[model samples]
Target: MTQGRSIRLFLVDGTPNGLLTAEIMNWTGHVLTGPRSKLSELVQRPECGRTGIYFLVGPDPDNSLRPLVYIGESDDVGTRLKQHNRPEDKGGKDFWEKVCLVTSKDQNLTKAHVKYLESLLIQNAGQVGRCKLINGTAHEYINLPESDRADMAFFMEQIRTVLPVLGLDFLRESFGNKAKAEPSDDAGVDSPRLYMQITKQGIQASAQEYEGEFIVMQGSTTRVDWVAQPGGYGALFAQLCEEGVLSEPEGKVRRFTKDFAFSSPSAAGAIVAGYNVNGRTTWKVDGSGITYGEWQDRQVSAAAAAAAAPE
Candidate 1:
Protein backbone atom coordinates (compact mmCIF):
# COMPACT_ATOMS: atom_id res chain seq x y z
CA MET A 1 0.00 0.00 0.00
CA THR A 2 1.12 3.54 -0.73
CA GLN A 3 1.05 6.25 1.92
CA GLY A 4 -0.17 9.79 1.37
CA ARG A 5 2.17 12.75 1.70
CA SER A 6 1.69 16.43 2.41
CA ILE A 7 3.49 19.01 0.31
CA ARG A 8 3.30 22.77 0.74
CA LEU A 9 3.67 25.20 -2.14
CA PHE A 10 4.12 28.95 -1.82
CA LEU A 11 4.09 31.59 -4.51
CA VAL A 12 6.77 34.07 -3.52
CA ASP A 13 5.24 36.99 -5.40
CA GLY A 14 1.62 35.88 -4.81
CA THR A 15 1.16 35.33 -8.54
CA PRO A 16 0.74 32.06 -10.39
CA ASN A 17 3.48 32.82 -12.94
CA GLY A 18 6.14 34.07 -10.56
CA LEU A 19 8.76 32.25 -8.49
CA LEU A 20 7.57 29.45 -6.18
CA THR A 21 8.83 27.25 -3.38
CA ALA A 22 7.85 23.68 -2.40
CA GLU A 23 8.53 21.55 0.64
CA ILE A 24 7.35 18.19 1.89
CA MET A 25 6.44 17.59 5.52
CA ASN A 26 9.11 15.66 7.47
CA TRP A 27 11.65 16.11 4.65
CA THR A 28 14.62 18.43 4.96
CA GLY A 29 15.00 19.23 1.28
CA HIS A 30 13.53 22.41 -0.21
CA VAL A 31 12.81 23.26 -3.86
CA LEU A 32 12.66 26.59 -5.69
CA THR A 33 11.51 27.04 -9.26
CA GLY A 34 10.65 29.80 -11.73
CA PRO A 35 10.91 30.86 -15.34
CA ARG A 36 14.29 31.97 -16.70
CA SER A 37 12.88 35.49 -16.87
CA LYS A 38 12.76 35.49 -13.07
CA LEU A 39 16.36 34.37 -12.69
CA SER A 40 17.33 37.62 -11.00
CA GLU A 41 14.65 37.22 -8.34
CA LEU A 42 15.31 33.49 -7.86
CA VAL A 43 19.01 34.09 -7.23
CA GLN A 44 18.20 36.52 -4.45
CA ARG A 45 16.47 33.82 -2.32
CA PRO A 46 18.59 32.61 0.60
CA GLU A 47 18.17 29.00 -0.56
CA CYS A 48 20.12 29.84 -3.72
CA GLY A 49 23.33 30.29 -1.69
CA ARG A 50 23.35 26.70 -0.45
CA THR A 51 24.95 23.68 -2.07
CA GLY A 52 22.34 22.00 -4.29
CA ILE A 53 21.43 20.37 -7.56
CA TYR A 54 19.62 22.35 -10.27
CA PHE A 55 17.84 21.57 -13.51
CA LEU A 56 17.58 23.72 -16.64
CA VAL A 57 14.58 22.83 -18.80
CA GLY A 58 13.23 23.83 -22.22
CA PRO A 59 11.17 22.32 -25.02
CA ASP A 60 12.90 20.13 -27.57
CA PRO A 61 13.05 21.78 -30.96
CA ASP A 62 12.09 18.53 -32.66
CA ASN A 63 9.69 16.92 -30.16
CA SER A 64 7.35 19.12 -28.19
CA LEU A 65 6.42 16.27 -25.85
CA ARG A 66 10.00 15.57 -24.83
CA PRO A 67 11.93 18.46 -23.33
CA LEU A 68 15.68 19.14 -23.32
CA VAL A 69 17.19 19.14 -19.82
CA TYR A 70 20.57 19.88 -18.28
CA ILE A 71 21.40 18.89 -14.66
CA GLY A 72 24.22 20.28 -12.54
CA GLU A 73 25.32 20.87 -8.93
CA SER A 74 27.10 23.78 -7.30
CA ASP A 75 28.44 24.89 -3.90
CA ASP A 76 26.79 28.26 -4.33
CA VAL A 77 23.82 27.84 -6.64
CA GLY A 78 23.15 31.58 -6.88
CA THR A 79 26.57 32.29 -8.38
CA ARG A 80 26.28 29.32 -10.77
CA LEU A 81 22.87 30.54 -11.92
CA LYS A 82 24.23 34.03 -12.56
CA GLN A 83 26.87 32.51 -14.82
CA HIS A 84 24.22 30.47 -16.61
CA ASN A 85 22.13 33.65 -17.04
CA ARG A 86 24.84 35.13 -19.30
CA PRO A 87 24.54 35.25 -23.08
CA GLU A 88 25.26 31.98 -24.87
CA ASP A 89 28.51 33.32 -26.33
CA LYS A 90 29.64 34.11 -22.75
CA GLY A 91 29.32 30.42 -21.66
CA GLY A 92 25.60 30.36 -20.75
CA LYS A 93 22.90 28.16 -22.25
CA ASP A 94 20.25 29.68 -24.51
CA PHE A 95 17.86 26.73 -24.79
CA TRP A 96 16.52 26.59 -21.22
CA GLU A 97 13.40 28.61 -20.34
CA LYS A 98 12.87 27.51 -16.71
CA VAL A 99 15.07 26.55 -13.75
CA CYS A 100 14.47 24.31 -10.69
CA LEU A 101 16.86 23.99 -7.78
CA VAL A 102 16.87 21.57 -4.79
CA THR A 103 18.61 22.30 -1.51
CA SER A 104 18.27 21.27 2.14
CA LYS A 105 16.52 23.42 4.78
CA ASP A 106 18.94 22.20 7.49
CA GLN A 107 21.93 23.52 5.52
CA ASN A 108 23.67 20.15 5.97
CA LEU A 109 24.11 19.36 2.28
CA THR A 110 27.78 19.56 1.26
CA LYS A 111 29.56 19.72 -2.08
CA ALA A 112 30.08 15.94 -2.08
CA HIS A 113 26.45 15.20 -1.26
CA VAL A 114 25.08 17.34 -4.07
CA LYS A 115 27.60 15.88 -6.56
CA TYR A 116 26.40 12.38 -5.71
CA LEU A 117 22.77 13.43 -6.07
CA GLU A 118 23.44 15.07 -9.44
CA SER A 119 25.09 11.92 -10.79
CA LEU A 120 22.19 9.73 -9.70
CA LEU A 121 19.66 12.18 -11.14
CA ILE A 122 21.46 12.21 -14.50
CA GLN A 123 21.61 8.42 -14.62
CA ASN A 124 17.93 8.06 -13.81
CA ALA A 125 16.93 10.70 -16.39
CA GLY A 126 18.84 8.78 -19.06
CA GLN A 127 17.20 5.48 -18.18
CA VAL A 128 13.71 7.07 -18.21
CA GLY A 129 14.27 8.51 -21.72
CA ARG A 130 11.54 11.11 -21.08
CA CYS A 131 13.72 14.04 -22.16
CA LYS A 132 16.93 14.86 -24.03
CA LEU A 133 19.78 15.29 -21.55
CA ILE A 134 22.19 18.02 -22.63
CA ASN A 135 24.83 17.35 -19.97
CA GLY A 136 28.06 15.52 -20.67
CA THR A 137 28.86 12.28 -18.82
CA ALA A 138 27.91 12.27 -15.13
CA HIS A 139 30.96 12.21 -12.88
CA GLU A 140 31.55 9.34 -10.44
CA TYR A 141 31.04 9.98 -6.70
CA ILE A 142 32.02 6.74 -4.99
CA ASN A 143 34.08 8.15 -2.13
CA LEU A 144 31.06 9.15 -0.01
CA PRO A 145 30.40 7.02 3.09
CA GLU A 146 27.86 4.19 2.85
CA SER A 147 25.64 5.83 5.48
CA ASP A 148 25.66 9.11 3.58
CA ARG A 149 24.79 7.24 0.37
CA ALA A 150 21.67 5.79 1.99
CA ASP A 151 20.64 9.22 3.25
CA MET A 152 21.07 10.72 -0.20
CA ALA A 153 19.00 7.94 -1.71
CA PHE A 154 16.13 8.83 0.61
CA PHE A 155 16.58 12.49 -0.26
CA MET A 156 16.31 11.63 -3.95
CA GLU A 157 13.04 9.81 -3.26
CA GLN A 158 11.58 12.94 -1.71
CA ILE A 159 12.69 14.88 -4.76
CA ARG A 160 10.92 12.39 -7.01
CA THR A 161 7.72 12.84 -5.00
CA VAL A 162 7.80 16.62 -5.24
CA LEU A 163 8.91 17.22 -8.82
CA PRO A 164 5.90 15.63 -10.52
CA VAL A 165 3.56 17.86 -8.52
CA LEU A 166 5.34 20.85 -10.04
CA GLY A 167 4.61 19.53 -13.59
CA LEU A 168 8.15 18.28 -14.13
CA ASP A 169 8.07 14.60 -15.09
CA PHE A 170 11.38 14.04 -16.83
CA LEU A 171 12.55 11.99 -13.87
CA ARG A 172 9.46 9.74 -13.78
CA GLU A 173 10.32 6.26 -15.05
CA SER A 174 8.05 4.81 -17.77
CA PHE A 175 7.80 1.16 -16.66
CA GLY A 176 4.18 0.94 -15.46
CA ASN A 177 4.51 -1.89 -12.94
CA LYS A 178 7.60 -0.31 -11.40
CA ALA A 179 6.35 3.28 -11.62
CA LYS A 180 5.76 5.36 -8.50
CA ALA A 181 2.63 7.05 -9.78
CA GLU A 182 -0.44 7.01 -7.53
CA PRO A 183 -2.62 3.93 -7.81
CA SER A 184 -6.00 4.05 -9.48
CA ASP A 185 -8.62 5.86 -7.40
CA ASP A 186 -11.10 3.00 -7.10
CA ALA A 187 -9.48 1.48 -4.04
CA GLY A 188 -6.48 0.13 -5.94
CA VAL A 189 -8.59 -1.60 -8.60
CA ASP A 190 -6.43 -1.92 -11.70
CA SER A 191 -7.73 -0.76 -15.05
CA PRO A 192 -8.67 -3.40 -17.59
CA ARG A 193 -6.21 -4.19 -20.39
CA LEU A 194 -7.91 -2.84 -23.52
CA TYR A 195 -7.36 -4.02 -27.10
CA MET A 196 -7.37 -2.38 -30.54
CA GLN A 197 -6.87 -3.75 -34.03
CA ILE A 198 -7.09 -3.08 -37.74
CA THR A 199 -8.31 -6.37 -39.13
CA LYS A 200 -7.66 -5.57 -42.79
CA GLN A 201 -3.98 -4.94 -42.09
CA GLY A 202 -3.68 -7.72 -39.47
CA ILE A 203 -2.72 -5.11 -36.86
CA GLN A 204 -3.43 -6.07 -33.21
CA ALA A 205 -2.44 -4.26 -30.04
CA SER A 206 -3.18 -4.17 -26.32
CA ALA A 207 -2.88 -1.25 -23.89
CA GLN A 208 -3.76 -0.15 -20.38
CA GLU A 209 -4.43 3.31 -18.98
CA TYR A 210 -2.24 3.94 -15.95
CA GLU A 211 -2.14 7.22 -14.11
CA GLY A 212 -3.42 9.10 -17.16
CA GLU A 213 -0.87 7.72 -19.67
CA PHE A 214 -1.92 5.14 -22.24
CA ILE A 215 0.81 2.50 -22.56
CA VAL A 216 0.96 0.39 -25.72
CA MET A 217 2.26 -3.00 -24.66
CA GLN A 218 5.21 -4.91 -26.09
CA GLY A 219 4.67 -7.19 -29.14
CA SER A 220 1.78 -5.04 -30.42
CA THR A 221 1.77 -4.90 -34.22
CA THR A 222 1.76 -1.82 -36.46
CA ARG A 223 2.06 -1.03 -40.15
CA VAL A 224 5.47 -1.16 -41.83
CA ASP A 225 4.83 2.15 -43.61
CA TRP A 226 2.93 5.15 -42.25
CA VAL A 227 0.26 6.40 -44.70
CA ALA A 228 -0.57 9.85 -43.27
CA GLN A 229 1.16 13.19 -43.86
CA PRO A 230 3.81 13.98 -41.25
CA GLY A 231 2.09 15.76 -38.41
CA GLY A 232 2.57 15.54 -34.61
CA TYR A 233 1.66 11.88 -34.67
CA GLY A 234 3.81 11.34 -37.73
CA ALA A 235 6.71 13.08 -36.05
CA LEU A 236 6.28 10.95 -32.92
CA PHE A 237 6.11 7.81 -35.04
CA ALA A 238 9.37 8.76 -36.70
CA GLN A 239 10.93 9.39 -33.32
CA LEU A 240 9.88 5.95 -32.07
CA CYS A 241 11.40 4.38 -35.17
CA GLU A 242 14.63 6.37 -34.72
CA GLU A 243 14.80 5.27 -31.09
CA GLY A 244 14.37 1.61 -32.20
CA VAL A 245 11.17 1.21 -30.19
CA LEU A 246 9.68 -0.56 -33.22
CA SER A 247 11.29 -3.73 -34.46
CA GLU A 248 12.03 -4.39 -38.13
CA PRO A 249 9.05 -5.74 -40.03
CA GLU A 250 8.71 -9.51 -40.19
CA GLY A 251 6.43 -9.27 -43.20
CA LYS A 252 3.90 -6.46 -43.70
CA VAL A 253 3.73 -5.77 -39.99
CA ARG A 254 6.18 -4.21 -37.49
CA ARG A 255 6.06 -4.85 -33.75
CA PHE A 256 6.57 -2.70 -30.69
CA THR A 257 9.87 -3.96 -29.24
CA LYS A 258 8.99 -2.73 -25.75
CA ASP A 259 6.23 -0.99 -23.90
CA PHE A 260 5.91 2.68 -24.93
CA ALA A 261 3.68 5.31 -23.31
CA PHE A 262 1.67 7.91 -25.20
CA SER A 263 0.07 11.07 -23.91
CA SER A 264 -3.35 9.81 -25.01
CA PRO A 265 -4.99 6.79 -26.52
CA SER A 266 -5.60 8.71 -29.75
CA ALA A 267 -1.88 9.22 -30.17
CA ALA A 268 -1.26 5.53 -29.63
CA GLY A 269 -3.97 4.68 -32.13
CA ALA A 270 -2.43 6.99 -34.71
CA ILE A 271 0.84 5.07 -34.60
CA VAL A 272 -0.68 1.59 -34.37
CA ALA A 273 -3.02 2.17 -37.32
CA GLY A 274 -0.39 4.10 -39.29
CA TYR A 275 -2.84 7.01 -39.55
CA ASN A 276 -5.18 9.20 -37.53
CA VAL A 277 -7.82 7.40 -35.44
CA ASN A 278 -10.34 8.05 -32.70
CA GLY A 279 -8.92 5.68 -30.09
CA ARG A 280 -11.82 6.17 -27.71
CA THR A 281 -14.21 4.61 -30.25
CA THR A 282 -11.70 2.13 -31.69
CA TRP A 283 -10.23 0.48 -28.59
CA LYS A 284 -12.44 -2.17 -26.96
CA VAL A 285 -12.42 -3.64 -23.50
CA ASP A 286 -11.29 -7.23 -23.51
CA GLY A 287 -14.04 -9.91 -23.11
CA SER A 288 -16.80 -7.29 -22.68
CA GLY A 289 -16.27 -5.81 -26.17
CA ILE A 290 -17.35 -2.38 -24.92
CA THR A 291 -15.65 0.60 -26.57
CA TYR A 292 -13.10 2.57 -24.57
CA GLY A 293 -15.14 5.71 -25.02
CA GLU A 294 -18.22 4.09 -23.51
CA TRP A 295 -16.30 2.73 -20.56
CA GLN A 296 -14.74 6.14 -19.88
CA ASP A 297 -18.09 7.84 -20.20
CA ARG A 298 -19.64 5.47 -17.67
CA GLN A 299 -16.87 6.22 -15.21
CA VAL A 300 -17.37 9.95 -15.63
CA SER A 301 -21.13 9.72 -15.13
CA ALA A 302 -20.69 7.56 -12.03
CA ALA A 303 -18.34 10.13 -10.53
CA ALA A 304 -20.71 12.97 -11.25
CA ALA A 305 -23.60 11.07 -9.69
CA ALA A 306 -21.51 10.31 -6.61
CA ALA A 307 -20.58 13.98 -6.29
CA ALA A 308 -24.21 15.12 -6.53
CA ALA A 309 -25.58 12.64 -4.00
CA PRO A 310 -26.87 14.06 -0.67
CA GLU A 311 -24.48 13.67 2.25
Candidate 2:
Protein backbone atom coordinates (compact mmCIF):
# COMPACT_ATOMS: atom_id res chain seq x y z
CA MET A 1 0.00 0.00 0.00
CA THR A 2 1.43 3.36 -1.07
CA GLN A 3 0.82 6.37 1.20
CA GLY A 4 -0.80 9.52 -0.23
CA ARG A 5 -0.76 8.14 -3.79
CA SER A 6 -3.36 8.46 -6.59
CA ILE A 7 -5.22 5.59 -8.23
CA ARG A 8 -7.32 5.22 -11.39
CA LEU A 9 -10.06 2.59 -11.20
CA PHE A 10 -12.05 1.25 -14.16
CA LEU A 11 -15.09 -0.95 -13.46
CA VAL A 12 -16.55 -3.06 -16.27
CA ASP A 13 -20.32 -3.67 -16.28
CA GLY A 14 -21.76 -7.09 -17.12
CA THR A 15 -24.88 -9.09 -16.46
CA PRO A 16 -24.71 -11.50 -13.43
CA ASN A 17 -20.91 -11.08 -13.43
CA GLY A 18 -18.48 -8.15 -13.41
CA LEU A 19 -14.78 -7.44 -12.73
CA LEU A 20 -13.18 -4.53 -10.84
CA THR A 21 -9.55 -3.63 -11.66
CA ALA A 22 -7.75 -0.73 -10.02
CA GLU A 23 -4.64 0.94 -11.54
CA ILE A 24 -2.65 2.45 -8.71
CA MET A 25 0.14 5.01 -9.24
CA ASN A 26 2.69 6.02 -6.58
CA TRP A 27 4.36 9.37 -5.89
CA THR A 28 7.47 8.42 -7.89
CA GLY A 29 5.50 7.64 -11.09
CA HIS A 30 5.48 3.84 -10.60
CA VAL A 31 2.41 1.77 -11.46
CA LEU A 32 1.15 -1.06 -9.19
CA THR A 33 -1.53 -3.69 -9.77
CA GLY A 34 -4.22 -4.68 -7.25
CA PRO A 35 -5.97 -8.07 -6.89
CA ARG A 36 -8.75 -8.44 -9.45
CA SER A 37 -12.11 -9.05 -7.78
CA LYS A 38 -15.29 -10.37 -9.34
CA LEU A 39 -18.66 -8.78 -8.57
CA SER A 40 -20.18 -12.18 -7.66
CA GLU A 41 -17.15 -13.03 -5.53
CA LEU A 42 -17.57 -9.80 -3.54
CA VAL A 43 -21.29 -10.46 -2.99
CA GLN A 44 -21.18 -14.25 -2.32
CA ARG A 45 -18.07 -14.58 -0.13
CA PRO A 46 -18.46 -12.89 3.28
CA GLU A 47 -14.75 -12.36 4.09
CA CYS A 48 -13.72 -11.13 0.60
CA GLY A 49 -17.07 -9.34 0.25
CA ARG A 50 -16.35 -7.42 3.44
CA THR A 51 -13.34 -5.91 1.66
CA GLY A 52 -15.58 -3.19 0.31
CA ILE A 53 -12.77 -0.70 -0.24
CA TYR A 54 -9.66 -1.23 -2.39
CA PHE A 55 -6.58 1.04 -2.54
CA LEU A 56 -3.82 1.17 -5.19
CA VAL A 57 -1.37 4.07 -5.18
CA GLY A 58 0.97 5.28 -7.94
CA PRO A 59 3.04 8.39 -8.75
CA ASP A 60 0.96 11.40 -9.80
CA PRO A 61 2.50 13.30 -12.71
CA ASP A 62 0.95 16.55 -11.52
CA ASN A 63 2.02 15.84 -7.90
CA SER A 64 -1.54 15.59 -6.53
CA LEU A 65 -2.63 13.00 -3.95
CA ARG A 66 -6.07 12.26 -5.35
CA PRO A 67 -7.58 9.74 -7.74
CA LEU A 68 -8.37 11.10 -11.20
CA VAL A 69 -11.72 9.31 -11.35
CA TYR A 70 -14.05 7.08 -9.24
CA ILE A 71 -16.89 4.62 -9.91
CA GLY A 72 -19.50 3.82 -7.25
CA GLU A 73 -21.24 0.60 -8.34
CA SER A 74 -22.06 -1.31 -11.50
CA ASP A 75 -23.26 -4.76 -12.53
CA ASP A 76 -20.43 -4.95 -15.08
CA VAL A 77 -17.41 -2.95 -13.99
CA GLY A 78 -15.21 -4.27 -16.82
CA THR A 79 -17.70 -3.27 -19.50
CA ARG A 80 -18.03 0.21 -18.01
CA LEU A 81 -14.24 0.62 -17.98
CA LYS A 82 -14.09 -0.45 -21.64
CA GLN A 83 -16.64 2.22 -22.54
CA HIS A 84 -14.49 4.96 -20.99
CA ASN A 85 -11.33 3.66 -22.67
CA ARG A 86 -12.94 3.37 -26.12
CA PRO A 87 -11.52 5.91 -28.59
CA GLU A 88 -14.82 6.12 -30.49
CA ASP A 89 -16.48 7.75 -27.50
CA LYS A 90 -15.92 11.43 -26.64
CA GLY A 91 -15.05 10.35 -23.05
CA GLY A 92 -12.08 8.23 -24.19
CA LYS A 93 -9.30 10.83 -24.38
CA ASP A 94 -6.43 10.17 -21.97
CA PHE A 95 -4.44 12.64 -19.80
CA TRP A 96 -6.35 15.64 -21.19
CA GLU A 97 -9.73 14.30 -20.09
CA LYS A 98 -9.31 12.62 -16.69
CA VAL A 99 -12.37 10.50 -15.77
CA CYS A 100 -13.42 7.87 -13.17
CA LEU A 101 -16.41 5.65 -12.52
CA VAL A 102 -17.74 4.13 -9.21
CA THR A 103 -20.32 1.43 -9.62
CA SER A 104 -21.85 -1.75 -8.13
CA LYS A 105 -23.30 -4.96 -9.50
CA ASP A 106 -26.29 -4.71 -7.14
CA GLN A 107 -29.38 -3.49 -9.05
CA ASN A 108 -31.44 -2.61 -5.97
CA LEU A 109 -29.01 -0.01 -4.66
CA THR A 110 -30.17 2.01 -1.63
CA LYS A 111 -31.20 5.63 -2.16
CA ALA A 112 -28.75 6.72 0.53
CA HIS A 113 -25.85 5.14 -1.36
CA VAL A 114 -26.96 6.69 -4.65
CA LYS A 115 -27.06 10.11 -3.01
CA TYR A 116 -23.66 9.61 -1.44
CA LEU A 117 -22.21 8.69 -4.83
CA GLU A 118 -23.84 11.78 -6.39
CA SER A 119 -22.30 14.08 -3.77
CA LEU A 120 -18.87 12.59 -4.35
CA LEU A 121 -19.27 12.97 -8.10
CA ILE A 122 -20.41 16.56 -7.75
CA GLN A 123 -17.43 17.51 -5.63
CA ASN A 124 -14.87 15.96 -8.00
CA ALA A 125 -16.68 16.53 -11.31
CA GLY A 126 -16.84 20.28 -10.70
CA GLN A 127 -13.05 20.18 -11.05
CA VAL A 128 -13.03 18.19 -14.29
CA GLY A 129 -15.60 19.54 -16.75
CA ARG A 130 -16.15 16.06 -18.20
CA CYS A 131 -17.59 14.32 -15.11
CA LYS A 132 -20.80 12.36 -15.76
CA LEU A 133 -23.17 9.82 -14.18
CA ILE A 134 -24.60 7.05 -16.36
CA ASN A 135 -27.62 5.08 -15.15
CA GLY A 136 -27.12 1.32 -15.27
CA THR A 137 -30.83 0.82 -15.97
CA ALA A 138 -30.30 2.30 -19.41
CA HIS A 139 -28.43 -0.86 -20.44
CA GLU A 140 -30.76 -3.84 -20.73
CA TYR A 141 -27.91 -6.37 -20.58
CA ILE A 142 -26.49 -5.13 -17.26
CA ASN A 143 -29.21 -6.06 -14.74
CA LEU A 144 -28.09 -5.21 -11.18
CA PRO A 145 -29.70 -7.20 -8.36
CA GLU A 146 -32.15 -5.20 -6.28
CA SER A 147 -31.53 -4.09 -2.63
CA ASP A 148 -27.74 -4.32 -2.50
CA ARG A 149 -26.92 -1.79 0.20
CA ALA A 150 -23.49 -3.11 1.18
CA ASP A 151 -22.09 -2.99 -2.35
CA MET A 152 -23.45 0.52 -2.84
CA ALA A 153 -21.70 1.90 0.27
CA PHE A 154 -18.45 0.27 -0.76
CA PHE A 155 -18.64 1.82 -4.22
CA MET A 156 -19.28 5.32 -2.84
CA GLU A 157 -16.25 5.27 -0.54
CA GLN A 158 -13.98 4.07 -3.33
CA ILE A 159 -14.87 7.13 -5.44
CA ARG A 160 -14.14 9.69 -2.68
CA THR A 161 -10.56 8.59 -2.08
CA VAL A 162 -9.55 8.92 -5.76
CA LEU A 163 -10.99 12.42 -6.49
CA PRO A 164 -8.43 14.67 -4.73
CA VAL A 165 -5.34 12.95 -6.22
CA LEU A 166 -6.75 13.49 -9.74
CA GLY A 167 -6.59 17.28 -9.35
CA LEU A 168 -10.37 17.58 -9.24
CA ASP A 169 -10.22 19.33 -5.86
CA PHE A 170 -7.80 21.98 -7.15
CA LEU A 171 -10.07 22.66 -10.12
CA ARG A 172 -13.14 23.00 -7.90
CA GLU A 173 -11.34 25.54 -5.72
CA SER A 174 -10.19 27.56 -8.74
CA PHE A 175 -13.71 27.65 -10.20
CA GLY A 176 -15.19 28.76 -6.88
CA ASN A 177 -12.76 31.68 -6.66
CA LYS A 178 -13.48 32.70 -10.26
CA ALA A 179 -17.24 32.75 -9.68
CA LYS A 180 -16.83 35.07 -6.69
CA ALA A 181 -14.65 37.64 -8.53
CA GLU A 182 -16.87 37.98 -11.62
CA PRO A 183 -18.29 41.48 -12.33
CA SER A 184 -21.79 42.44 -11.20
CA ASP A 185 -24.51 44.85 -12.45
CA ASP A 186 -23.90 47.35 -9.64
CA ALA A 187 -20.23 47.57 -10.54
CA GLY A 188 -21.08 48.56 -14.11
CA VAL A 189 -23.67 51.26 -13.20
CA ASP A 190 -21.38 52.80 -10.59
CA SER A 191 -19.25 54.35 -13.35
CA PRO A 192 -21.64 56.77 -15.07
CA ARG A 193 -18.71 58.62 -16.67
CA LEU A 194 -17.93 55.52 -18.73
CA TYR A 195 -21.49 55.07 -20.02
CA MET A 196 -23.05 56.22 -23.32
CA GLN A 197 -26.63 56.03 -24.68
CA ILE A 198 -27.94 54.75 -28.05
CA THR A 199 -31.23 55.87 -29.61
CA LYS A 200 -33.70 53.21 -30.76
CA GLN A 201 -33.79 54.64 -34.31
CA GLY A 202 -30.05 53.81 -34.62
CA ILE A 203 -28.96 57.31 -35.61
CA GLN A 204 -27.84 59.14 -32.51
CA ALA A 205 -24.71 58.18 -30.50
CA SER A 206 -22.45 59.47 -27.72
CA ALA A 207 -18.68 59.13 -27.58
CA GLN A 208 -15.48 60.54 -26.08
CA GLU A 209 -13.01 62.71 -28.05
CA TYR A 210 -9.25 62.93 -28.56
CA GLU A 211 -6.94 65.40 -30.40
CA GLY A 212 -9.62 67.09 -32.57
CA GLU A 213 -11.11 63.69 -33.51
CA PHE A 214 -13.73 61.57 -31.77
CA ILE A 215 -12.53 58.58 -29.76
CA VAL A 216 -15.20 55.91 -29.26
CA MET A 217 -16.01 55.66 -25.59
CA GLN A 218 -14.97 52.41 -23.92
CA GLY A 219 -17.89 50.40 -22.54
CA SER A 220 -20.38 52.64 -24.40
CA THR A 221 -23.80 51.10 -25.03
CA THR A 222 -24.32 53.49 -27.94
CA ARG A 223 -22.11 51.28 -30.14
CA VAL A 224 -24.69 48.50 -29.81
CA ASP A 225 -26.74 50.02 -32.62
CA TRP A 226 -25.21 53.13 -34.22
CA VAL A 227 -21.94 53.04 -36.15
CA ALA A 228 -18.87 54.97 -34.92
CA GLN A 229 -19.74 58.11 -36.95
CA PRO A 230 -23.39 58.12 -35.82
CA GLY A 231 -22.23 57.59 -32.23
CA GLY A 232 -19.91 60.58 -32.55
CA TYR A 233 -22.76 62.67 -34.00
CA GLY A 234 -24.98 61.78 -31.04
CA ALA A 235 -22.19 62.76 -28.68
CA LEU A 236 -21.92 66.08 -30.48
CA PHE A 237 -25.66 66.62 -30.01
CA ALA A 238 -25.32 65.81 -26.29
CA GLN A 239 -22.51 68.37 -26.08
CA LEU A 240 -24.83 70.96 -27.69
CA CYS A 241 -27.48 70.27 -25.06
CA GLU A 242 -24.83 70.72 -22.37
CA GLU A 243 -23.80 74.07 -23.96
CA GLY A 244 -27.46 75.34 -23.87
CA VAL A 245 -27.66 75.75 -27.66
CA LEU A 246 -30.06 72.76 -28.01
CA SER A 247 -32.56 71.08 -25.68
CA GLU A 248 -33.38 67.41 -26.20
CA PRO A 249 -36.77 66.14 -25.04
CA GLU A 250 -36.91 62.56 -23.77
CA GLY A 251 -38.51 61.15 -26.93
CA LYS A 252 -38.51 64.03 -29.40
CA VAL A 253 -36.08 65.77 -31.76
CA ARG A 254 -33.36 68.02 -30.33
CA ARG A 255 -34.62 71.60 -30.35
CA PHE A 256 -32.42 74.69 -30.74
CA THR A 257 -33.37 77.97 -29.07
CA LYS A 258 -34.95 80.47 -31.49
CA ASP A 259 -32.05 82.91 -30.85
CA PHE A 260 -29.35 80.22 -31.08
CA ALA A 261 -26.95 80.53 -34.03
CA PHE A 262 -24.69 78.07 -35.92
CA SER A 263 -20.95 78.76 -36.18
CA SER A 264 -20.62 76.66 -39.37
CA PRO A 265 -22.85 76.33 -42.47
CA SER A 266 -22.55 72.53 -42.06
CA ALA A 267 -24.11 72.74 -38.59
CA ALA A 268 -27.05 74.83 -39.90
CA GLY A 269 -27.60 72.47 -42.84
CA ALA A 270 -27.66 69.44 -40.53
CA ILE A 271 -30.45 71.12 -38.46
CA VAL A 272 -32.47 71.75 -41.62
CA ALA A 273 -32.40 68.03 -42.43
CA GLY A 274 -35.01 65.67 -40.89
CA TYR A 275 -34.73 63.62 -37.68
CA ASN A 276 -32.40 60.56 -37.92
CA VAL A 277 -30.43 62.56 -40.52
CA ASN A 278 -27.07 61.61 -42.01
CA GLY A 279 -25.18 64.84 -41.35
CA ARG A 280 -22.28 64.43 -43.83
CA THR A 281 -24.61 64.59 -46.87
CA THR A 282 -26.88 67.29 -45.42
CA TRP A 283 -23.98 69.44 -44.17
CA LYS A 284 -21.20 70.83 -46.40
CA VAL A 285 -17.63 71.87 -45.55
CA ASP A 286 -16.98 74.37 -48.38
CA GLY A 287 -18.83 74.28 -51.71
CA SER A 288 -18.23 70.50 -51.87
CA GLY A 289 -20.84 67.98 -50.72
CA ILE A 290 -19.60 64.73 -49.06
CA THR A 291 -21.35 61.91 -47.24
CA TYR A 292 -19.99 60.22 -44.14
CA GLY A 293 -19.41 57.01 -46.16
CA GLU A 294 -17.23 58.91 -48.62
CA TRP A 295 -15.32 60.57 -45.78
CA GLN A 296 -14.52 57.14 -44.30
CA ASP A 297 -13.24 55.91 -47.70
CA ARG A 298 -11.03 59.00 -48.01
CA GLN A 299 -9.54 58.37 -44.59
CA VAL A 300 -8.80 54.72 -45.45
CA SER A 301 -7.10 55.75 -48.70
CA ALA A 302 -4.97 58.37 -46.92
CA ALA A 303 -3.84 55.81 -44.36
CA ALA A 304 -2.96 53.30 -47.10
CA ALA A 305 -0.96 55.95 -49.01
CA ALA A 306 0.99 56.93 -45.87
CA ALA A 307 1.82 53.29 -45.22
CA ALA A 308 2.99 52.73 -48.80
CA ALA A 309 5.28 55.82 -48.77
CA PRO A 310 9.02 55.13 -48.21
CA GLU A 311 10.78 56.32 -45.05
State each candidate's clash count: 0, 40
Cα lDDT of candidate 1 equals: 0.88
Per-residue lDDT of candidate 1, residues 55-117 (tens digit): 999998877668999999999999999998889999998999999999999999999999999
**Distance (Å) between predicted and true CA of 244, model 1?**
2.6
lDDT of each: 0.88, 0.35
Score every model by TM-score: 0.88, 0.23
TM-score of 2: 0.23
RMSD in angstroms, all models? 3.2, 22.3
Q: Choose the strongest candidate by lDDT.
A: 1
CA error at residue 111 for candidate 1, angstroms: 1.1
